[model samples]
Target: MPIRMVDDPQDPQESNNDGGGGGGNSNFPGGGGGGGLFNLLPLLLGLFRGKGIIFLLIIGAGAYFLFGRGGGGCNMGNLSDLGGLARGGFLDPKQFERANIYEPLADDNTKNPIPEKANLMAYAPAVGNQGEQGSCVAWSSAYAARTILEASRSGQQGEATKFSPAFLYNQIGLDGCQGSYILRAMEYMTKQGSVPYDKFPYTDRDCSRQPDQSLIRDAGAFKMRGFNRLSLGDRNDAIDLRAIKENLAQGAPVVIGMMVGPSFMQGMMGQEVWQPQAGDDQMSGFGGHAMCVVGYDDSKFGGAFLIMNSWGPEWGRNGFGWVRYNHFKYFVREAYGLEPMPKTGAAATAAFTCEVGLVQVTQQGNKMVAGSYAPLRSISNNVFETVSPLAIGSRFKMEVKNSTECYIYVFGKETDGTSYTLFPYPNANDATKTKYSPFCGITGTRVFPHDKSMTPDSIGTRDVMAVVVSREPIDWYETNRKISSNPASDYASRVNAAFAGKQVSNVRFQSTGKGTMQFTTAPSQNQVVAAIVEITKR
Candidate 1:
């Protein structure tokens, strides 16, 4: 009852060359086993049944899965490529535990990386009296500390931690000019236990007397001697990367400074206010007067150099400036001292809000013009009034505000009463434009939305004012268009109607008070006046 099994006729031929064989080699062209045509037929049929047909169906299924149903491409690489999936490693538990960390994760659509810190430190005091030569170092040091302390607690809970230069100065009980010897101040601060000198090692002799440079003409030698004598651990002397990074990370204040010769004074004097000139180097003009090392640079300069300044924020770029590598050495040797210590105690805890403001009004015949009124004021404490009666071909400050947003504008006014809006303003809308918008309508008006806007109430109480004096004819067409289309009011009816088609010549100020001011100069100057009016949030 045993039966023999028969092989299927469609089975592949037994030959090695055919790539399908049971035991025989298929190298021969014409073998006794099977003809090439017969072998090809079975092979093709087998492929069609098992692979070609199935492969085509699989490809169609894959295409449908990707394009037809929005399944997305098969990016089978790192899991991180998939949104929110961790590919590198497990998520840090601390990251999840920290409330402030991973804030971007809560929102699925957020693309911005989370910031390391929640808030940055704002400049301290916001405003202070310009310090004298002897007091400058002490003033600057105290200011630096206070600034760092304020910045450190910006995003933390409760009232911001504050520092007082005056208090620190009193506590340390060191008094001398900023250019004077720093050894005394350092010793006094150390003795008072205000700062730890464990990391600082310098005898009084190291910083006591000024270098006798009468015969030493070499700037290099002068630089070397001072650098060598400076104590390694001294906050002013040592370029401690770890400390600097830690302080910045913790929001601590660090002081930096630079050295300059009398040439600095010459540079300042050459300016228009001190001495007018066709072209002058503005950088050398300021950063003169004293030596101050407040903070260090973070780039390739790393902690090698410090940030120093001669004037307040009103003087330099927001009162923030930088110095070169080891530049403070020359100043330290020449001045023979470090910055003074800061004031301590409850005064350091005092808090004050800072605000900036601008007011603009047109001028005619040495008097303010009417319907050309714009009075801008800040509700905050910090206010800087620009040097007013701004000369023709000169610049002035322009303020723009909404309830939630605020901005400052700087512009130039012409002697003939015509004014031109400058770079910063026009570039704000579209950053690519090379030529500034000269049309009065385009330049003068600043629009702000009422909802979530920057308004007078939002700004608080600080105020500043600037006036443009010019002799050119006002561009009436441009001025009228700006006023009419302004978001604040119906300027077409209120302003354009009165002087609709008049060849407006002379203009004057109507009034200026409480976050508002108006001016009436020539049509050209009106543009500047209009800019000032628009800046005021009220």
Candidate 2:
């Protein structure tokens, strides 16, 4: 065997010994000696540990990528494809088409006195510290514009004032913050010109504020604002944009003015003369008051001017007067500015016609029903059927052309002459009242022979009756008293006398098959009245 030399444990000079033994030496590995197993163990362990951790991390990342991303991804492709199914390849085609549409410029001939576009800086005064005064002036200008527009639409030829108290009050509240009031009023009118009549219920008190329960305490409870109170087919501002637009589009005249006196009352009295007209004193019939204009003529005032007024139709030249143009403009700018007209439309008129003819009247107890009988078959023929129904709770004007022979009972309904008892000559004692009563005598103009034997070769041979319907028990005493009370007035008062004491829930006519069965009498009375009739609906 080759000779194997083992180094000594400690030898300074021995080549194998090297003298760098375990004692705390820097060259020592585990024990301060080089090449020791303790030092090498750490390096070996670190290499293997790092490799294991990195492998585990890689596996976790792969798992997350396959499971997490695949499970939660959105289906954007499905949403993107839905546009193909829309009507116009868009979500809302109707709105889209209207959005990009263009409106033609309004005709110059149709323009009103007030300019379509309002220039506040040109007409209005600069706003000063007294903001309220400025606001009031601005509101007055807008009111003037509104009145001018109205007059133009009505075909009223004249120079109208742009400023109006009614228009201002409507635009601004009596309280402070008149600027805000003007804005709201302008917004309202620009949107809708006519405020619903029913909305502002009439109160017994002075016309200061809106009617409320306090005002109606003594008056019977009734709706102040609603469809029932307005004229037929009238809509509120919420849905009447077209009406407002039409009014503004007409290019009506407007004038703004300033009162020189200390108060509105004094200003009207001419205490301090500003723009004195020749007969202005005569125009000041009422106490000192400020008025707004509705129309004007530039030639009359050497240029253009506006009309003004204080009273309604019953007062002051049908509720209108006039003012100068530049003066009115200055007043308007001092206040604020005119508001744009609303984009709404006008109120609808009633389609039905009121005609006179023979209407069958039948009354039973407290109820009454009526229908017109005509030989013709057109809508104008006054014929009604099951489909073409009469309005419920409608007032009627009934007359007694002749009452010499037949005593009218005004029965609510005919019941085989057995179900209910008939009061004889119920409407006979009041012969004078018969002139206004629904139970009129058979006049030759409307009367026809009841029986062929009575009048041979009679052209008009149908006997007409006026019908009244009710649900309560009929009071003969009250009926007769009412019929005879006001004989000179009209037939409506006489008929209303019977139902005046009782509350009426609803009233409708029995439908006739032919169009000739409509109401035959004209609606000329002011009181509540109805024709009486009975018929079996087919």
Candidate 3:
């Protein structure tokens, strides 16, 4: 058996056609040599013969066990729902892993040339409500991001645009009925951007399976340089109140996750200006309650923050009110701010050699399952330029500044356009843990005696991308996969190279990122830092 690097089935960036080549054991119930429905007779008969329960479940759940072997079909909604309320603007605790990857940069004050004390909300449009759905995160985040775009345009907020939370919720594969994480929601907005509310509009039903691209293809969507997590003492601790004020003073509202409890609910319902004191209730209710911090007033209501709640204009002083600073801190859990970027034809193109700050990677088994880029801490760090190509024996190095629980996987592509998984190759196999989940093994910062380097067998210019994820051994599962008898017509045939005898047996090392040092799998609180370098012979 051999392993293959295949393009993600769900991803659209790669071609869907699985090319016609390779041979192996039948990728289906019977030898992949018979005609259509008749070939399934044996499998169907076996289901009735003492395996009815398991057979029913496989058909019922419709889980894609065959990997990229399925045909394009209608995407029914709710089957894949995670029950997380597409919470518009939450910060995932997992993101803290790469928080310290870049050095801190100064804030840009030129965007807000107004006096130090001013409220951008004065120009903001009236707020809307989340209705019965747990979509406050989407509504609040859209409101804040929309207001920033509006202000930068007309220098006022009165005619503020309303972006669609429903569009974001459904398009990003979030379950609006169930509460969602704000940070995850914001990530979608930052990457794909959002459309106007009226275009797609919010609905109370299960999220739509597909987004209407017609509504999303315009230049109206506002894309930020990126979002920022504003913390107080330590990133793991409470958010710094001063930082919140500074961001608000810039006329851009900050998104904060407030703890929703009885007292706070009562305050919003009763008083025009709500201020619930700490310890009003000992019981914790629903968490991930987020709202926009529009502005702060040191003189008004004894030093409080002006908040824009997405409970409709009919609630809380016409959908907006104030929270005393002391009470605000007691309930607020996470804070984030979006730095506005100039509206370009599209997002800035990636430089040949870019130092993308705060790279986050999610680990699944031994593979780096997912990766995303965050804004650089400083504008001066945008040192992405191309130089003379590197030849063979060009040494590469990666240094970790703030170590966290993760293992690094460095991959390279050479001038000849050949790809290689430099580290965590065939050498990193664990034979004993055949059934353990991805996290049930050694996990921590890899303590390498020295920097790891690689040399190319062929000479040419090259570039590299390094991904760090939780330390775990890669696992492969064997199962029946449906395949077309006519391989030329099968799309899965292109990416099913794993089924062929594509074996590589050079065990240079014995573990991927798995090490003897064990660490907690819980979300990291502190930041992690690391860098990738490529040295070419001059």
Residue ranges of candidate 3 with Cα displaced over 4 Å: 1-92, 95-116, 154-160, 173-176, 219-221, 281-283, 343-538
Each model's TM-score?
A: 0.25, 0.23, 0.45
What 10-residue stretch in candidate 2 is worst by lDDT? Answer: 224-233
RMSD of model 2, in Å?
A: 37.5
Whole-model Cα lDDT of every candidate shown, in order: 0.27, 0.26, 0.42
Ranking of all predicted structures according to TM-score, beginning with the best and ending with the worst: 3, 1, 2
Model 3: which ten-residue window has the lowest total lDDT?
13-22
Write model 2 residue lDDT over 1-538, tens digit each, in one string: 0101121122122112111111111121122222223334456556657578577556545433322212121111111111111000011112112111111111112221223222111122111111112233222333344434433334443233222233334334333322222233344444433322234422212224533454334222211110000000111101111111222223422222222212222232332112433222211121111233333343433332333333223222333333333333312211111222222232111111222233333333432334454222332111221222223222222222221111233422111111111222222455322211122111111221110001111112221223342221244445645554544443334455556644222322223353333332222222222453222221
Each candidate: how many clashes?
79, 99, 22
Candidate number that wins on TM-score, 1 or 2: 1
Candidate 3 lDDT over residue span 53-75, tens digit each: 57755753343321111312111
- Compose the digit string of candidate 1's lDDT tens values, residues 205-307: 2222232343123212111100111111212222222223223332334432222323323333222112112211111111223233334333422222233
TM-score of 1: 0.25
